[model samples]
Target: MSRPDILLYTANTMNGWKPLIFLHEAEIDYELVPVDLGRKEQKAPAYLKLNPNGRIPTIVDRGNGDFAVFESGAILWYLAEKYDRFLSHDPKERSETLQWLMLQMGGIGPMMGQAMFFQRIAKPNGDEVPYAINRYVAESRRLLEVLDTRLAGRDWLVGDAMSIADIATYPWARSYFWATVSVDGLPHLQRWFDRLDAMPRVQAALQLPEPRPSVFGEGDITAAAQENAARFKDQ
Candidate 1:
């Protein structure tokens, strides 16, 4: 097989899956270069040059003079602009799409990540902090409520179609159960989640690199948390 023009440096985490899902939806040919977080490969000197933040989901666009892009949100924007798909050209609709994308970047992602850290990782490691857990979990739920409200009477986050906003947020939001947050009362959000969750592209994206174990299954949740803790231990 011929080499793809894009090389995605990623893991199986929620953030890592963002661009992967987009790539599938856009039907772009790409290569997946899995970064081994457990081995601290993301912090290696070479990887640092690509992503100074030392994070997953970085991309090297071979078709664009080998340009490198880091941060999940920025990567999504770059791909959307380059491919001229999944992002609208209409002024108002484009702005609305960006607004919802920013919500995921600045709000949902961080809040839910913190909630998962406190409830799953920290707690499992015997570093349980009740205040921290309560704070993040509550904030996560509030963000979900905001999404729930926005999703009411609508199928997508922006305009009348699925855009980068939905692509970026779905991975994080669908993992709500693992974060100890509930989506029980948010019917609209639940509907949206089910809609995206049932898509073949979304399902296929989750299996790339490898299939991640479900937290609800017999998987070792504590071990998973411990692995994640190592990523932020020095931060």
Candidate 2:
């Protein structure tokens, strides 16, 4: 079979990492097109044609008539279905996997992203936004606790195997510091996080756009955040 030429347009954010995690795990051949969020490259006219939302982590399946997919979770689902891996063939297991994936999409990612914005970005702006900060932090923590409970007797989010559910959630949950929500007391979540972190594929995916770090340095982070704030102001 001829391998598809998949181009992933992404940055160094949680959502960006999710699809890469699945790609690496599935051993699918793909290319990385780094979108400079700090420079607002994602909002460019050409890029907007690929992802109308003007977001990173869009995938262009060039082998399939340049078919483009946007949104992190949706990208993972597409790849999983394409490769017949990560997601299960069993209907019950597949339903469970999708449910957990949605939890990350609707609850974990948004709440944690807001927490990071308020604590790391907005706080430094001197605006602080205490109400927003507290609300998201508390909510993120609550979500972490829920994950911990769900993971207590299980090794993976759904069934006995790792699936898109784990891939969808790990990136956000791993950055506990950024979200200002700790999983320290959630032993089960900690175990799950550590187990996934030890995987070589996960390590590789986390280091996308290598040799040039995706994470901002402390020295210029304030400026970086300010720039990002303007770019995502519509949110």
Candidate 3:
């Protein structure tokens, strides 16, 4: 079979990582094209045609005649179905797997990402900082706890194997590039996270150049981002 040319216009965010991790796990052949986020390149007119949402991780499936797939969770599932692996053979198990994926897409990802942004972006004055941080941190912790409970007796989310669900949720498991997760309290989640981390495919997918040290800008916004970066470090 002729391999599809996979054109991935993406940054190294969790959403982008999801698809690449899935591709590597499937051992599929494809091309990877980096979209320069540093230049606001995703907002260009050419990329707008591919994804009007102006997001990274937009994948073009060349084998499918250059059909495009947007949204990270959807793309992960598509890769699994296309590569014919890391998915359930039974219909019921497949449905459950998708359910978990949606939970991550709709719940964990959003809540955790908000926690990330608040921790690293929001200019909190007075009590806003602690309140916002506590709110989001508690919510994220609760969600992780739920996942831990659900994983009580299973090695994976669905069936007896890993699936697109794990790919969907792994990014948020360690947000902001291993920012502040303990991986200590949640034993089950830690185990699962380590299991995925140990995979050669996952490691290959994560094989990318570290972001170069650079200054963002020369003014106020730049200073704010730097401040957040500092506070993020303190956390």
Candidate 4:
């Protein structure tokens, strides 16, 4: 199937931003194909063919045999290996990068995602599940502390340079407050966040496919979310 040079199917969500950061940082040419989560577009048959899991942030690399890659972490890994960027060359450094990437992929990403769902999205829907909220928030905060400690004397997650681990982890960390987790006491994490926030590449990645509004905001998205929530509740 012919497609754009690099077609990214994604929503304006955290998981969606992960590979985007890498795409911009690596200077890979791509076209953004926004997926409307509010309308359940991801579950459509055509999209499901690209990603059996029916998730956003899937990439179809037309330059590489119309190859479709799904799952944010796997997408990042594929891009890094294909473009020969982010993932380190040294064995020890490469291992460190992959380990920290997995920390975001397996640990913080899932925990904080649930935290956001319960604390921010689900609550206003009259589905305030406190146990779920508290459990995820506490765990998400704990993960932030872990990142804080890991970044105490370092600038990046793995080696000296910013790798896929940092890219994979940044979107979730940037949305820490959405999880009701405070980073005030985590000075190192704050410093790292600020440092990355200042990067030109990171900034550009956050605002891909011009004309879309900023996804990161502390403002009210409840009404819009509720509309989408109603659809999800029926399932």
**TM-score versus the correct structure, for each prediction:** 0.93, 0.89, 0.82, 0.90
Tens digits of per-residue lDDT, candidate 2, 1-235, equal 7655799989879899888888898888888889888678988999999888998789989877889999999998998887798899999999999999999999999999989887666666566788998899899999999999999999999998899999999988887766767667899999998899799988798888642232323345556556656655544
lDDT of each: 0.88, 0.84, 0.72, 0.83
lDDT of 4 by residue, 1-235 (tens): 4444788998767789888888888887788888877688999999999999998889988888899999999999999998899999999999989999899989999999898777555776678999998899899999999999999999999988999999999989987765668887999999998999899988887775432232354445555455545755634
Task: Please provide, for model 1 over 1-235, each residue's C-alpha lDDT reduced to its tens digit, 9 standing for 90 to 100.
Answer: 6688889999988899999999998899999899988788999999999999999989999989999999999999999999998899999999999999999999999999988878766776668899999999999999999999999999999988889999999989988877889888999999998898789987799776777766423377667657666655544
Best by lDDT: 1
In model 1, the clashing pairs are none
**Candidate 2 Cα deviation (angstroms), residue 132:** 1.0
Model 4 ranges off by over 4 Å: 1-4, 209-235
Worst 10 residues of 2 by lDDT: 210-219
User: Best to worst by lDDT, what's the order?
Assistant: 1, 2, 4, 3
Q: Cα miss at 36, model 2 (Å)?
A: 0.2
Deviation (Å) of 182 in candidate 1: 0.7
State the local distance difference test value for candidate 4. 0.83
TM-score of 3: 0.82
